[model samples]
Target: MTYCKVCSLSGEHPGIVLDEQQVCNVCRLDSVGDLLVNYRYTQEVFEKFQRAGRTEGAPYDCLFMYSGGKDSTYMLDKFVTEYGKRVLAWTFDVPFESEHAAENIRLAKERIAATFVVDADDDGIKKMMREVFNRPAPRKPGNYLDEKLPCVSCRTFFVIRAILHAYRHRIPYIALCADPQQILTMESDVRRIVRGFYEAFGVALADDLFRGELEQLLFAHDDELPQIVFPFIAMRHEYDPDLIVAELKAKGLYASSPMETHCTLFPLLNYYSFTHWDCMFYKLNASSHARAVKRNGADGARSTFSLKFPRSLNVLEVEERLRTVTLRIAKGEGAAEEHEAALIDAFRELGTSEEAGRFIARSFLEMPAVAADMGIRLT
Candidate 1:
């Protein structure tokens, strides 16, 4: 349970390495400064994007990816009023979206000058989600898998959708509003990973041609791709989460449930990670969070190791926790009513048939055995 004195990152995980001064690797990166560049953020690069995106006659300067979460809501206002950029705000309407987030989106539409676009492909998304939960995901080093692999796949879908949307509308820039702490991009594996999730359904599937087209759009050549703008990185603003929460409340953008501003699936994802990874998002992202705070602090700095800060997780602890939760759930010990509650709400939101939801639930819960049967090693 030991943690870095400076950053509070738990040492229980195999990743948190502390130097003689009891400072963490992440903290050390910030001591001299290097985190922002590692995350692919540089003043020159950001300025270049700004200069390139100002071309005349583009329908909008930026196509904002609005998730209706705290970060996106705040960033949307900044992009429009402060930066004075015309924006086409977009949302990928998923069943996993929280009611509070929906309300925030509604408020933003009424108040902000940005044009709004919302779309959903429930049938397609459901199949993709089911695939993510049903199959064993390929292991990646670090805490990459610490967040449910579905979160990665789903967010990538959101990013890809925004890119294609920008291309279609002749928008030169796409604005991503993922919280500042979520600085890393895993698109290198996402193109193939997400493609396999769909193509595995079968060749007879009607999406074959459209699927290929979507892939090309998702992984288009640099010349063909829309330049992306990471709000916090580009703006170089110090992200104060507490302040954002207070402002959201003062501005009437407060989400109803505190636990749900991010997503309804969050709890379930944490449960999955806690059971299998011996860690949850709190632990999964501690290093990243620390790095963000360091670089965005009163004095700016950046460090991601020097790379490898998240190191491998404690697999033995994960195994024991998994066995405990599995047995407790099997015996109806009421160990995870909260997790099931979120899942139930999600099913209701999706209008999923009871039988289908139950099947998904059963399969997701039995994932460990399923992975074993498929000869996939988890943990």
Candidate 2:
């Protein structure tokens, strides 16, 4: 794979344009300046939040979207311990949540604040995934995978849910646990993609997939949405996964080692996008990712647990994960075995036929004309 010499991003990343010198466009565009600019803005936002303290004895000051992961739990700790803010923790219980995550949730509540676990509409989510995956590819400049990523659907659900929870509770700011790269991606095209989802598939089906109230929340204007907060992003923090896990373990609030298990569909998405677009979603944030690496360097910099953030993980680990998934797809082992089991259950429970899975997997295995158009030819 060809990589940008300066930023170390490769051709497999989305939004990566290489110059004659082999430096990625991110490097060419001066990503360091972008990172600093984002940092300043987010810092201002966070300070404004600090000034607007909660009313004394209010049920909560802010609603935190907690996933029982280290980044989120760290935010929970920071809010309760550092800032002394009354936080209400929210967890969307995706169907594939591990038992370890449940334990982490229990510990989180014990250590910090009251937690509310909202069970995701598993059947509905599955149906949407089925719809997104099974549909014929849309004619677009980049890969449909760029827009059709399941993470968009999942994250949008929580964003809307957090907004609704905030509205009901009178919480002004909804704190997110995303890092700089995640903050960039999370802010990208979420509301637009969701709006398109509803517009494409009638509101009646949307209402069927999501609750009536949530459907309304999804369609709300961008400005009308809750004020979202990114604490780590505001501070420009780059934390080691080891330190985060250690901190939680010391508090006896975490039960498992840090693992980078993304959504089951993510591997499939990565495989197809890399094969076709020669650029994946993670690459979209490469510029900001490169900034973090340059500022901290390899010794001090932590990986963002993304392929685009090559400096975050050791070269071997990154290559192994990428190659492993590629090999799996090449062998017709589409999703991970665990995910295959979950997908089977999802299809059955959601009343989606097996053909939906077949269609998505088949789409992943093919090299579309778009790749050839982009001059990404494979043997």
Give the alpha-carbon lDDT of every model.
0.57, 0.58
Candidate 2, superposed: residue stretches over 4 Å from native: 30-38, 55-58, 137-148, 188-208, 211-225, 238-240, 260-266, 269-379
> So what's the TM-score on candidate 1?
0.66
Q: Residues 191-235, candidate 1: write the lDDT tens digits.
A: 453465455454444254235556565466665556666656544
TM-score of each: 0.66, 0.69
Q: What is the C-alpha lDDT profile of model 2 across 1-379, one tens digit per residue?
A: 6777655666445455677888766666645685666667677777888888665544677888988877787778878888888777888777545455677888887878555656466666656655554456544444323643546666765676566777656676788877655554555233554576577566886777656765555666664555777777776556455677678889887775333223334444554454445444344444445556776786665445422333543332333345444545445465555434443433232222465443333333442332233232232
The candidate scoring highest on lDDT is 2
Provide backbone clash counts, one per model.
3, 1
The residue-level lDDT of candidate 1 at 342 comes to 45
